[model samples]
Target: MKKLRKMFVLMGTVTLMVNFCSFNILAEDGIKQVSEVQTINPRSGNVYYKYKIINGKKYKRLWSADKNAWVDPYWTLA
Candidate 1:
C-alpha cells in the first residue's frame, strides 16, 4: 500500500511539472505572436513626419505603425 501511494505521488508530481512547462511554452509563443503583430512595416509611410491641422493650427507629427497610433505632443511651427 505504501509503494502504491508513493507511485501515485510521483505520477502527480510529474504531471504537474509537465503541465507547468507546457503552459510556459504556450505563453512564450503568445508573446512572440503579439510582438510580431505589433512590428511596424518598414515600407509604410509612417516614418516621415506629416502635417496635421488641429484647432486651426498646423502641426507636424510622426505616426507609429508599431503602436498603430499617432505620436503625441505634436511639433508646432517655430
Candidate 2:
C-alpha cells in the first residue's frame, strides 16, 4: 500500500510537471489566444484587465493595462 501511494505521488508529480512545461511553452509561443477580458482579483474581487499567465513555479503572472504593470494574482490574493 505504501509503495502504491508513493508510485501514485510520483506519477502525479511527473504529470503536473509535463503539463506545466507544455503550458509554459504554449504561453511563450502565443499559441493560446489572449484577449482583453475583465477579471476580478480573487481576494479583492476588484476588476482588472491585461490578464495573462506568466510561466513560473512560485509566482503568478498577470498584465494589467490600467496599471501598465505585471502582477502575480496568487501573491496578490494570498
Candidate number with greatest lDDT: 1
TM-score for all models, in order of appearance? 0.40, 0.38
lDDT of 2 at 27: 83
Taking the tens digit of each residue's C-alpha lDDT, what string does model 2 give over 1-78?
A: 999999999999999999999999888876666689898766533335332344633433466655566555454321
How many Å off is the CA of 38 in candidate 2? 20
Query: What is the C-alpha local distance difference test score of candidate 1?
Result: 0.76
Count of clashes in candidate 2: 0
* Regions more than 4 Å wrong, model 2: 31-78
lDDT value, residue 33 of candidate 1: 35
Q: Lowest-scoring 10 consecutive residues by lDDT in candidate 1?
A: 32-41
The residue-by-residue lDDT of candidate 1 on 1-78, one tens digit each, is 999999999999999999999999898876643334476656654455668787887878776766677775657652
